[model samples]
Structure formats: C-alpha cells, structure tokens
Target: MILIAKIVSIDCNLKCDYCFYHRWNQNSNRLMSCGTLETLIKEGCDYSPICAQFIWHGGEPLLAGLKFFEKIIEFQNKYRKNGQNIVNKIQTNGTLINEEWAKFFHSNQFGVGISLDGPKNLHNTFRKYPDSDGSFDATWQGIQILRQNGIIPGIIAVINSANVIFPQEMFEFFIDSELKNLVFNPAMIKDDISGLPTGIVAKPTDYGNFINRIFDLWLKKDDPKIEIRQIKSVVHALIGGKYRSCRFKSECQKYPTIECNGDIFSCDGDEQNKNIRFGNIRQGLNHIFSSEIYKEYRRKIQRLRISCLDCQWYKICRGGCTRDYCSRSQELPKNYFCEGMKEVYQHISDSLKYYKILPL
Candidate 1:
C-alpha cells in the first residue's frame, strides 16, 4: 500500500495552469505537524510491517523545507518495525531544488519526481511564477543540480493542447535533456468537479496520434535509455507483469492520501471531493477500513462496469481512474482516455511483434 503525505497542504512557488490542487482550492497554510507524522508512521507500520511506500506530495512539498524531511527520516527510523521497510518518494515542481536539497535527497535515497513539461518554450507556456515569468530556466537548473548529485529524477509532464500538437518535439526534448524516466498526464477539464475555467484538454484522436508517433520514436532508438511511462506500462501489462500504474490497479483505494491535518482521502485526485474522505489518522486504520466510503470503494472495485468488462483492454486498463468516472456521474463509467489508450496499446502490440521482446 502507498500513503501519500500532503506535507505542505497548500504552498507552492510556481502556478502551473493545470494544477489540480489549485483548481480544487485545496491549498492552505496548513502543514503536517510532528505529532501527526508520528501517528501516521505508527499507523502505517501497524498496517503493513512487511513493506510500505510513503509518497511526499504537495502543492509543492519542498516548501516544507529540508529540516522537515530530516525529521521525517528520524521518525521513520524510530517507529519502523523489525524486518519492515519503508520507501520514501517525493513529487515536486523542480524550482526549489539546489545542491543541498539534491545532496539530502541523494543521501536519503529518496525517489524524486520532477514536473517538467518538455522544452523551455513548451514548459514556460503553462508553468510560471506569480509575476507571470517563465520558470523554465530555474527548473532546468534544478534538474541539472540533481543530475550532478547523481540523482536521476523521474520527469512528469502534463500534456495540454499547447504541447500535445508537438509530441515529437516533446519526445526529443526529454531525450536531449538526458531525462530517461518520464510520464505524460493528459490535462483534464471537468466543469462539475474542478470549478475552474476549462483549460486545453486534448482530443482522443489527437492524443492517440501523439502517443502513436512517440511510440514509433521510442522503438526506433537503438540503445534506448528512455522509459516513457505510458508505453512502458502497456508493454509491462502485455507481458503479464504486476505494474503499479493507478489506472491499471484493480483497487485504487489501496493507495490512500493523507492531508496535512491527518484526514485520509480515498485518492489524491478525489481529495477535494469531501464525500470520499473515509477517516483520519486519529480514527485508526480499523475505523477507516470499516467506513462507508471505503466499503463503497471496495464494492465498486469488485464489480467492474459492464462496458469495461466487454472491452478487450479491460484487464490491462481496469477501467482507468475512479476520479475520471466520478467527474462525469455517480456510477463508475469507462475511462475517459479509453479510445486513445486502446490506440496506443494496439500500436505497441503491433510493434512488439517485430521486436519480440516478450513471448508471442
């Protein structure tokens, strides 16, 4: 199971156009307290002593500062059970990272994920500071610092219409930047859920064509060091591996996110929807597991929608994200990216026939 700690609740340096936390009004002055951290660590240890992963997420987690993380490491050491292992990961907007931050991250063995939307031109289009100045230069500098410290940070790029048209350019940017690990998230615009003005959401056909072109580029590389998440996930699923993309997970609630105040949410994407909040750290895991929201989530997981079951890629996709379903209606609907995902999957499967990386 994964526990996402929204360490800083609401503070961020750059304002990315498609930021979900900002759109949902989830930002605040609230930050996780030491007592709350202790309680969370104890509860997590009790829940799974064998293995657990804690993802330090945020409005921008680094805003909590380096000392906060040092304390977290201390708490992890103090509470962790014998033979149990706890892995830590942080997802940040790369602007705050420096040599010291990189050193601490390296020494602590933290799996770092940086948000970079391709080249300067594309990245600056959406990711900017309060003054409306592009953060590309600062962010790129941070990425270079992390690399200098021997930390290969995973890159997460949100695909909006601005960058979606230039899939090849985006692909080459990552390759040229020497960024090997990457994930592209399609920007979602839901009027009912976000309560924000609709941004550029990629059309299914456009996204499919973009992915297909990138897949072709990915295949053509002779000694590929790059790992584009969407393609890699599809390839992994095709070969019958237990990959960890949430879209493919049978039960999304297994990975719950905890707010700075210790409020437990079913998932990060659904954090704004108060209806899905099961319980809090003080309530204990037993109480949370027995809550109505958790029970309902489990029920939904067990009973796959009829449309999803009929689809050929159902086993691999698992009907995609629950939040995507919640955006449209009360019932669990098929994935919003279903058509585009199918197109990418078919393209990869066809390409695999020639490479024969996995058994036929």
Candidate 2:
C-alpha cells in the first residue's frame, strides 16, 4: 500500500490557482511531528508484507525542512522488518529544490516529481509565489540541479485553461527540456456529491484535443522516449495490462493519506470531508482500515463498477476515478470527463489498430 503523507499539510510556498487544497486554511508552522512520524513508520512497516511505498506529499513537503526527511530515513531503518522493502518518493513544487536537496534525494534513492505546468508564460499564469511573482525560473533551476546530481526527476504538469489549448507546444516544451517522464493531469473543477459543478471547469473536449495532438506528435517521433503517464496507462490497458493509475481504475485502491496532524483519510480526495476520516496515525492502520466509514466508502465504489459494466471502454476507462464522478448517487454517476475520455480512448484504439499493434 502506498502511504501518501502530507508532511506539511496545505502550507505551500506558491499559490497555484487550481490547487484543490488551496482553499484550506493552512498553518505554515504545522508539520508532521517526529512522534507522529515514528508511529506511522512503525505501523506502515508492520502492515505491508512486501513493499511499502511512502509518498511524501504536501502543500510543499520541503517546507517541513530537510531535517524532517533525515528523521524519516532514520525511522524507516529502525522499524523496517527483515526482508521488507521500503521506498520513498516526494512530490514537490520544485521551487525549493537545491543542490543539497537533490543530492539528498539521489543518495537516498527517493523518486522525485517536480510540478511544471508547461513553459514560463503558461506555468506562471497559475503558479505564483506569495509576492505574486512567477515561479517558473526557480522550478526550472530545481530541475537542472536534480539532473546535475544524476537524478532525472519526473515532471507533473497540470492541464488547465492556459495550457490545454496549446497541446503541441506543451509536448514540445517537455521534449525540448529533456524531461521526458511526464504526467499531465487535466484540471477539474470542484463538484458536489450530488453532481453539481461549483466552480470554473475546463472544457473536456479541449483536454481530449490536447492529448490527441500530443499523441500524434509522440507517434511520429523517431525515438519516442517521452513517457506521458495517462497515454501510457491507456496503451497498457489496450495491451491487456492493468491500468495502475488511480484516476482510471475500476475500483479505487486503498492508499491512505496522513495529514500533518496525524489524522488519516482513505485517500487524498476525502481529505476535506470530516466524515470520511478513517482515524489517526496514533490509532494504527488496523483501526483505520476497519473503520465503518472506510467500508462504506468502498461500498460506494461498487455502484460505479455496476454503472460501467456496459460501457464499451469499460476495460480502458473503468468508469474513471470515483473522485471524478459527477454524481455520487446510487444512480449512474457518470464521469465528469466521460465524453472527452471516450473520444481519446477511441482515437488511441484506432491508432493502435492502424499500426498493426492490435488486430485490425
């Protein structure tokens, strides 16, 4: 099980416009205490029979300071059971990465993912520091630093209004930057459980067009080393491989996310809902996993499974992420991006057939 620990809660250095956690009242000083961290590590080690991946997530995880991570490594060594593997990964804004941080990640074998939402103009449109200055320069510098340390950090670019319209440019930017490991997440607006859109939402067709353009470019590449996570997941699904991405899976994986205060939720999507809180790190995973609330959450997903059983792209789309459901009712809770997703999936399937990768 992957444990997504929000080590610093929602306290980020940059104020990104579409951040889901941006609405939270974050106390910058609030960080995961050593005591809380130790309990989490011990419980996590004991629970996972095989590999335990600890994903250090945050408003900005580095805000917890470098020393905080040193403690994490120390505790992992202390509590890990014999023959049990432990892995660490950090998702950061990349504005704070320096030589010291990059070297630390490289030394400890931590998977680093930096958020870069395209080139300066598009990226700076949303990702800005407290002083209202753009963060592209700092983030780009961080990527360079990581590369210099022989660490190729993965890039996470969010597809929003600013960047979704320029798919080819966005694809070329990543290719030109020599940062090929990419994950492009379409920006989604907040929707109530009853399936009502409450905020500005990106056009689903625009996102589909964006991915199609990128896919065409990628297909034409002499040596397509560019790895777009969403496209890769779709290709894997078409080839009869499991789509491991949480966004497209039929059933949501139970990856618990721990808040800075040690409060645990089944996943990041349930973070804001107080009713869905499983328990706290101090309460142990057994208590959290066994909680009635979590059970009910799992039960709710079954409806999606039933809803998508008849879908032509059921295997590839898997009803989309439950979190992306426009409605959470017992009735069909169609995916918010269903139309666009269908178009994209069909395009990919047709392309595969044309290439003779799949039987025509």
Candidate 3:
C-alpha cells in the first residue's frame, strides 16, 4: 500500500523560526472541507490495493477539531465493505494535544509524531509561540497527557545549529521520557523564503560525521528507544519499480500526492507552486497519471541533466528531493541536498557492509 499524507488543518499556534509554510494563526490554515475530504478518500481507495496508509499533516492538524477527523474515519469505515482500508497518522506540534486528543488518537490506533527540539534550552531557541513565549513547557505538558493516556508520541527533530550539539542530549531525553522510534530530519529552508540557514550548510563530510555520531549513540549509548531518520526511503527502496525518479524505487510505481482543496501535485512537498501542479481533485485519478503536467514532471525526473545521469549515486538518489533541489538552488548544479544525499549514501553503504545488506 502507498502512503498518503493529507492536511487536516492549516492553523498553528507556534510561529517557528523556520516554518516553510509561513503559517500565521488559527485562521491562516485552510482546512480540508468535508466534501473535498470525502471525495479524495473515496477516489484514493479505488487503487488496486485495498489497504492504504493515510497521514494527517498540517500547520497544526488538531485545530481542525477531533470531530472533523472522526467524521473522516467514519466515512472511510463505511467504504470498508468495498475493500477500502485506511490507517491514520498525524504530524503535529503537540500544543493542542491534551487528555481528550490523546484518548481519541490512541483509541483510533493512529501513529502520532510531535515536533519537539529537545530540552527547554534547545526547544525554545527557535520553536515558540507567536507571543514569544517558550513552547517547551506547553509541548511537554501535552506529551505528558499523551503518555498518561498510554500513547507514546514519536519525535520529529529538525537539526539546526541551535540543536546540532544536542543530538546526544536529545537521545538521552527520549530515553528518560521512554519514547522511542523518532525521525531526525535536518532543517530545510527555501531560497526565496527568509529563515535561518539550515544548520550552517553542513557539507558531505560534516553530514558523514553527524551520521557517525548518531551511530555512535545507537550502538554504544544504551538508548533503546531512539532510532534515527532512515525508515522512509530505505523501506521504499526495498519495495518498488524502476522507470525513473531517484527518490522512488520505481518511477512506474505511481505514488501520487493529493493536496487539500482538490488540487494534485507530482509530489507532496513541492506542490504549492502552480507550475508543478497536475490536476484538481474534481478530476478523476485515472486521467492525472496520463496528463501532460504529470508527463512533464515525470520527464524531469527521468532526465535531470547530464551531470545527474553520470553521477554514480544518481539512481539511488532519484535526483534528490525536488523541493530541496529547486527551492534551495533555484537553478541547476546546486541542489542543497547534494551534500545530504552524499552523506546518506556513504553511511548506508558502510552500514550495509557491516550487515551484508549491500556490497562490501
């Protein structure tokens, strides 16, 4: 089954230092209305497979109210008779989570991921409410509510200079809190957008060192609950096809991303731009895969450039993340993710040698 992430709410309480969406307040978020959501889910279920994973992502999804999400679950459950299956997950900042939220989420068996930077010193360094109050206290309090309800929340740590030195500390915090299975994504910024540099532009070597540090802790630090950010791509590669796109195992696999408001994009992360958009939700899913817009996006993935074609790591890298490539560079030969992929590939290769998952 393919993974589908939807935006439940555009509203967010915190105005983080590097919020790429530039979210403002409760009103800023444009939530997915019930009509659009129903249509999308119904259409999405028509794929060959009966079971699918749905992830709720947003400026802050909880602001949409638990009732709205329940309605979605109910709708999907109704379609289960037709062999449609849906698994729920949410990516939130944890500010809105409380006893009620925890109960609903845990009872529903949703995988919840909270955005926390670590100790108060590091968390408050960049992540904060618009009023300039520190978010660590409120977020941790929310996490406490989840734990009380018997739901362990996974962490989504953005590696910034502010928190770079605290990776070990963060792992320790997770261990003490008894939370395991975390994702460590580096801070990402757009060239057109204004924000702090994404942790001082760590070159490949710096990233290699960072990976080594993480492995150091994972192997020797005695932190049983901690797992670094490798699940998504590694699992994807182990699974699918091979026409193109370095990101996916096979370009022919056709994992499409549907945006809120009836719009579709070639990919999820970089769909805001009109240029890359495919079709609207009103359109049937069948037509989108064959449309010119999709063809163009697919072609771009196939023919990235001479340099990309020649690179030894091109196939596995899948031309890197389009958002990171085009947004950070805004031009060719300057994908900011170049360094990151280099580090990831090298480390994974080294790791595989030790485990015999790849060539020695």
Q: Pick the candidate with the highest lDDT.
A: 2
Q: Each candidate: what lDDT?
A: 0.80, 0.82, 0.65
lDDT of 3 by residue, 1-360 (tens): 343444543457788877765533545657788888877766666643467667777667787788888887887776554555567788888988888889899888988899998888988988888888889988999899998998888888776666666567877787677777766665656444542245433344444455556665675755554555543454235333223322433352254555567676655554333256678766866777678877877666555544566777666665654444443334444455566566666666566567766656
- Each candidate structure's TM-score, on Cα atoms with residue i matched to residue i, is 0.91, 0.93, 0.82
Model 2 residue 140 distance off true place after TM-score fit, in angstroms: 0.8
For residues 61-157, could you state the per-residue lDDT of candidate 2 as single tens digits? Answer: 9999999999999999998887989999999999899989999999999999999999999999888886789999999999999999999989999
Deviation of model 3 at 318, angstroms: 3.1
Candidate 1 Cα misplacement greater than 4 A, ranges = 24-27, 192-199, 271-274, 301-304, 326-333, 356-360
lDDT tens readout by residue for model 1, 76-137: 89888999988899999889899999999999999999988889999999888867899999
- Model 2 sits at a Cα RMSD from the real structure of 2.4
lDDT for predicted candidate 1 compared with the true structure: 0.80
lDDT of 3 at 231: 37
Could you give the C-alpha RMSD of every candidate to the true structure, in order shown?
2.6, 2.4, 4.1
